[model samples]
Target chain A: MSDFQFDKIALIGIGLIGSSIARAIKLHGLAREISISTRSPLTLARAEELELGTFYTESAAECVKDADLVIVSVPVGASGAVAEQIAPALKQGAILTDVGSTKASVISQMQPFVPEGVHFIPGHPVAGTEHSGPDAGFADLFEGRWCILTPVEDTDAEAVRKLRSFWESLGSRVDEMDAEHHDKVLAIVSHLPHIIAYNIVGTAEDLETVTESEVIKYSASGFRDFTRLAASDPVMWRDVCLHNKDAILEMLARFSEDLAYLQRAIRWGEGDKLFDLFTRTRAVRRSIIEAGQDIAEADFGRHIRHEK
Target chain B: MSDFQFDKIALIGIGLIGSSIARAIKLHGLAREISISTRSPLTLARAEELELGTFYTESAAECVKDADLVIVSVPVGASGAVAEQIAPALKQGAILTDVGSTKASVISQMQPFVPEGVHFIPGHPVAGTEHSGPDAGFADLFEGRWCILTPVEDTDAEAVRKLRSFWESLGSRVDEMDAEHHDKVLAIVSHLPHIIAYNIVGTAEDLETVTESEVIKYSASGFRDFTRLAASDPVMWRDVCLHNKDAILEMLARFSEDLAYLQRAIRWGEGDKLFDLFTRTRAVRRSIIEAGQDIAEADFGRHIRHEK
Candidate 1:
């Protein structure tokens, strides 16, 4: 606990991340009253139908009024707008945070619009599935996941600590990193991977000789893995590409360079080069499993997992 | 049924595919006697210990003697050597098949050495897990998966029918294609994906800016999906690259072109361009699910899957 129970928690965008937060909060009984607001009226009604919050509204301003913790869970491009609308309504000393994938741009986008008395701390929970919307969330989404908080320098230490505790209560292990560094790290780990997945799937679909049905039929051999990532929410990923432009470009450059090297190896019949690269990557998967980040089941246990 | 019982079945290379076929055959009680062999003594011993077959041998020749069905499940690179070794001992009119990824290369390598009366069929069962070896096999590995056969024009129809029936009994839907066409199709669907996955994982590992631990900690966001493909057998991927060079290079060139276009879009802040591509790719994923090629569960249903 942050020494005081959160009287009311306002979720400013009830999408996958926001709805998951609502579920987790309700499951743990962490909030006295949960307020959820999204710009889309249909989504707001859906949130109400899902019983995701005690208060549901389409007005971002109405969602944050009198709330002790105001969490903005919108696209990076929409963050500033939500912050601007909710700024005047946020209760004094209320914590303001976001669950955006990118951190540095998010801080810049919402930081200026944040009211002076509100303790604005930027947080990104490194968790989600390809599915989106209010219906796509679950209470355990954040469990055993890493949530990185990139609080600005000169921010209140008490606010950072309490925010860290808040995420910890939500089943996340929190780590602190500079916002710029966080962007760079996520560029390689998250943004670049998503971009690459989208690009490859597009490439596969656009092929002239291979039929769509054949690609689908044989996807289990390998291509199916990329589709899961490519299926992520388009708007969210578009904002990610736009907001973290520099870092993502840097990573794309590196990935292209590596791909060129690999292409040359394949062209020249350099089996050892291909073998060496392939062999080295197996270790990374092993490390991820050892770190308890992934399940060790073969074929991701897709065969057995489907039974349930 | 094939109109005749499989009197004696021989499996060469008791790795993941080989052992899985062994299990599937046993599960269906499709064969009267099963013989397993691998060049590696330890793996052969493991198959024996696992009760994968009624007979085990170190020599491919000895393993296939008088066998009515012989399956070569070794790495694609090993297809030639196994076919040569087993040719002399194979029974007349017996069905001979190899479960190699690159059908053209496997056909080229094994077709010459195949005995005249033996039906040499090159097939690829588009199913497997990242994990390899005998212990990784299970009866259901091929269930609801596609198996592509690329048989030469002069091959016996009855033999091909029997082989198709065998795979059907093992729970695969069979499709026939020309060897060159099979290469091209798999190059895009399977080969290119694994190469890109391996290349990206290698690039992430080689980076100095993002610590390896950081990549591991946050992999679930998107990077983990690639790791599964990257962790696939090194030698198998190497052979795929070498064997299907032209088709793979073509797909790689197209993928690189698409990636460059995407990179430019990101650099120029083309949100609509990025958004359109991201949204369009989601449809392919939907098609894959509708085709019954992938589970529709979010994040591959990884959370619910872990409980078991």
Candidate 2:
């Protein structure tokens, strides 16, 4: 059997994820024709400059006309607006999907606008760098990563399978889960970490005693690791916070409670308590390395080659 | 003038820092001979197997006897114990220094036991990995990294300069700060981050809703970055928490306050507030990269070569 191929693929919001999908499709020859669209004229021009697609347009509706697949790669907060704009132009029986970090909110926002025959499968490819825009993307962004598809009940089974296969062809390991579960899982893993990183960096920046230069100079000591996540695209993260408020707030509550316990342990000079907690957390990192989710080298394998 | 060279060097506690110092000394030919000592016989044996130093001993006193320089690279909690054990055996006019994370506690712990003529300068080389022990050290570990020295008020200026040069020969950029300031700076830059990482990982592991395997699988989303710091040596971090209690507690307070503000913003769906904070923090990462404290590549420059 031949691999899945869409007659025309419409990619809305040609930012990092959109541009990456464009590159991956081109590299794999997964689409007969690709159309790129973004509201910003500057971004659309950049996408054209990068040759990310055969057809480029500033209109989302124009980009989706006659397209067999529509991948909405915009921020979560923009999902409703994008879906509303493209609804009239969506082709019948087309597989419509998204690459938003939050699933439940995106599903609710886009579901009303998705045409009757069009399949709306919410997805989150659990991969990214702290970079955004067309130049920040590459074809192999999804390689060795998990792409989660959260299809709502009563959706077409054939559409789900086709979407899964398409992602697999792009080098992603595809998995299916409920939208609510996906949101909860991501709340703890992705959203909470980013928030903590931003908050810590902000804390460091606001300190009167510790100068910004000192924070930068001594950052390699540990603080620099958090800065990478803190440096992520603000708009996407802001939409994530607005869209997945409940789950994120729950995770934040748990995180703060745990941090309070740790602070108390330090205040009371409870060395054993601190030691046990620290030791327990180390095993998780080992498991991540063993599972091939992270590099096995120490210090993320940076600057190790020069060691004598 | 030639750089300062020791006729014999004693490395008390053959862990990551000690072994790295041993290798740097050998690589740069800064010492004629190196004696290694550790409380753990197993670590001492491993140091011998690695040939980290010329002489291996279980006795700190024996290791320091007649040595021109003695470096105590133990947990901050053990500073006083090591100092008391090796005081009488320290050679006259020999420079005694440490590579502990905290300076004020180390200085307070080791100062009373210092002999009249021996120059004791408390130092913290702000470079390390999540790994520890003799096998984890490398000769170039200190290259382009900062080593902060907190010398006492009455300490000999010549001895401080000599110790500073010794660290510089090991490929460090050395700076001098008061003990209290060093403790405060490190508490924010290093200790708090590790503690926060440990706490968040602990919280995730303890969550009833999220399976451990799920966390291991989806770590790349963001949580994995914190795990690197969280996976650090339990004993070493526990010692840091106890020895630098006041400064660490202060930083924790500031961190928690900032996190609370962020949490409230998320709860209220304040996109602008979230966006503003996230945007502000990105500059610090840029500053760190500009300072050469961290690599400019995304994701700490790990596994990017395979991306197309």
Count of backbone clashes, every candidate in sequence = 0, 0
Q: Please, what is the whole-model Cα lDDT of each candidate in the order they appear?
A: 0.91, 0.91
lDDT of 2 by residue, A118-193 (tens): 9999999999899899988888889988999999999999999989989998999998999988889999999999
lDDT by residue (B1-308, candidate 1, tens digit) is 46335989999988889999999998898998999999999998899899999999999999999899999998898888888888889899999998999988898899889878989888999999898999989998898899999999898999999999999998899999999999999999899999999999999999999999999999988998899999999988899899999999999999999998999999999999999999999999999888888899998888775531
DockQ of each: 0.76, 0.69
Residue-wise lDDT of candidate 2 within B1-308, one digit each (tens)? Answer: 44539889999998888999999999999988899999999999999999998999999999999998999999899999999999999999999999999988888889999999999988999999999999999999999999999999898999998898899998899999999999999999999999989998999999888888888878889999999999999999999999999999999999988888888888877778999999999999988888888787767766573322
TM-score of chain B of each: 0.97, 0.97
TM-score of chain A of each: 0.97, 0.97
Candidate 1 deviant stretches above 4 angstroms: A1-4, B1-4
Docking class of 2: medium
Question: Least lDDT summed over 10 consecutive residues: which range in candidate 2 chain B?
Answer: B299-308
